[model samples]
Target: MKASWRARLAGPGYVILNGIRVINIITFLDIIAASVVMLVKISLTSGFFFFEAVTHAVTAGVSIFLLISELPWLCSYFDRDWPLLGHNSGFITLGIAMFMLGAGVLGNLNRKDMGQDHLGMTFWQIVLSAGVLALVMSTINFVSSFVFADGEKGVTARQIRIYGAVAGQKGEIPRTGSHRTFRLSMKREDTLPIYSPQAGRKSPTDRNSTRFPLKIEKISSPPPNDAASSRYSRDESGIAPPDLAHHPALKGEYI
Candidate 1:
């Protein structure tokens, strides 16, 4: 049977792997192209190159870092037991890469020779456009990394609590069926009331109240009822009361 889109596409893990591969390919190509262009520009002109050098350096650094990030996926595919780098490192690296790209592009644009008068209009336009494209792509990758990483391999920003991953450290992913046990222990201080009566303090009693007049208020009796008084009163014979004689609850003969 043919696999459905769900099976083929799988989840963010596959997507991230494919994305990293694409990024590596693009970076590789960009490095080659930029190197050739830088060489040509250098050979053609003898002017001092400050911005160009910095731009290339930043691009090279970002590209290398991105390329190295593929190691985790590769290790997993090979069924190796390598300590997985926390997935949050992906977005953080992408953000840093984007910032570097933007800074490099802006610095490069500051050069006086960047205009059509010095470099051809076509070449200058291509440089500016490529920089913009790179920035947009980097931004998209960064955002997607953040969004897709939710609950993935249990390596989220909130779960990890770290901005980036540490190399050579063992990173464990929480299992789906794993249970977390939380214990609640009630100590004497916690189980007991916050306030307790002082030692040697006498409880409210008739003797104490008569002498010291305790602040406790006596419970008042219910109001007098003529019917209740007559119903419960017995005659001189001390037999049963006439009112309770026919009562359903007291109809049975007394012992």
Candidate 2:
């Protein structure tokens, strides 16, 4: 049982599961951190107003949690149904909208024109600082999302299927040259199928027909008395037998 458990844990499924868990944990932490940052910004803008800070913190926490949780489904939906607005473009649009909304709200906040006596900072000054901070945070989050969108796991399922199809009977990874060509081919949107309902119904003959035919020539064994066979039986000095050395084809050669 222990060995089986260990083997299961070591399997690709376990690795993918662990990776997904790690990604979720990291995403949750990011949401919390963003909420905390927003709370800090709100406090700073409101001169450390406790009630306002608490309200903003709660609101931001819930909003961020929900947004991050639903983000994957939202992106997937857009990617599947809305080709014009792709996943990356949707994310970019959302990020831009969020930054603009936050900045606009902060900019329009009602506060004293003159600097506050206690905080020693004017309303607009705090708003400006918050706006800048918000922009930086949003930009960082957007870039991180775009960069790590595929997660820290290995090749995706589609990539694995493409590789398997490309490899065919070899059952090994493609050579460096072929790999480079495959990578280049992957850039084309229509080069590989992402998902196909008919994939399972594909016959081996059909698949083989699609692949370039391998040239497999018959490799016949050499004759028993041939110079090629006698070369291996030669002396340590690498000299062939008298009969082999005297052969017309091997007259001047060592064999």
Candidate 3:
């Protein structure tokens, strides 16, 4: 077979791509490291917050980028449809896994508010906050193997494994295919419930409830046609004579 100028003169194919791979791997790994440590420190002692959970998820993503970074060489072991980038990929995956595992362990150490004051703390509050951080960080570490692992060592990056199982030819094709159907049929099923324990539950004082035992009396109303002044008992101001402004003698009488 005649080798192309790029293949022969360019040294191994891996040399050409290794620069990008190294940078991506290191950048991703450092982010994962920082996230893991942050996740752990909080999960064990304090706990996760809004963005911290997102960062933990990002850590898991790094492993995937690491795997993709190594595709230059793992493909040569057998007759493969695509070449596998060899040892570099596996080494990167292993390194990521080891770090994640360590982070998970560090996160696990401070479970149950082991470091905080016993007073002024609620049981579920600690569990809810701390456990989530631990869980997210631990999940990132565990899933790192699946997301970024390359199975072999000492394989050059150029060995190429496009199908992933190229040496075995068992990997399935990724569908960049129709997402239109998915989009049309997509259903959003929120796992969280819309209702809470207090929802629709009423207290005794609430007017809507019949369970209130407070005494209530129905008072009789006065007839509309009758003058209030002539009805029943009256106040001092009522049933009184009209107040005359002044008294004057009649026209026929002396002043």
Q: Give the winner by lDDT.
A: 1
TM-scores of all models?
A: 0.43, 0.25, 0.23
Whole-model lDDT, model 1: 0.48
Give per-residue CA lDDT, model 1, range 31-108, as digits (tens).
435433443453225455665565566576655555555434454432243233334344555555655665555455
Candidates sorted by TM-score, best first: 1, 2, 3
Off by over 4 Å in 1: 1-13, 16-24, 35-39, 42-55, 68-88, 156-171, 174-255
All-Cα superposition RMSD per candidate: 18.9, 20.7, 24.3
Better of 1 and 2 by TM-score: 1
Model 3 stretches astray by more than 4 angstroms: 1-5, 9-12, 16-23, 40-51, 61-65, 68-255
Question: Each prediction's Cα lDDT score?
Answer: 0.48, 0.44, 0.40
* Model 3 C-alpha lDDT per residue in residues 8-86, reported as the tens digit of each score: 4223333423453454454345445544544554543335365656656565564554444344433344224322223
Most TM-score-accurate candidate: 1
Predicted structure 3, TM vs. truth: 0.23
User: Whole-model lDDT for model 3 versus the true structure?
Assistant: 0.40
Count backbone overlaps in model 1: 0
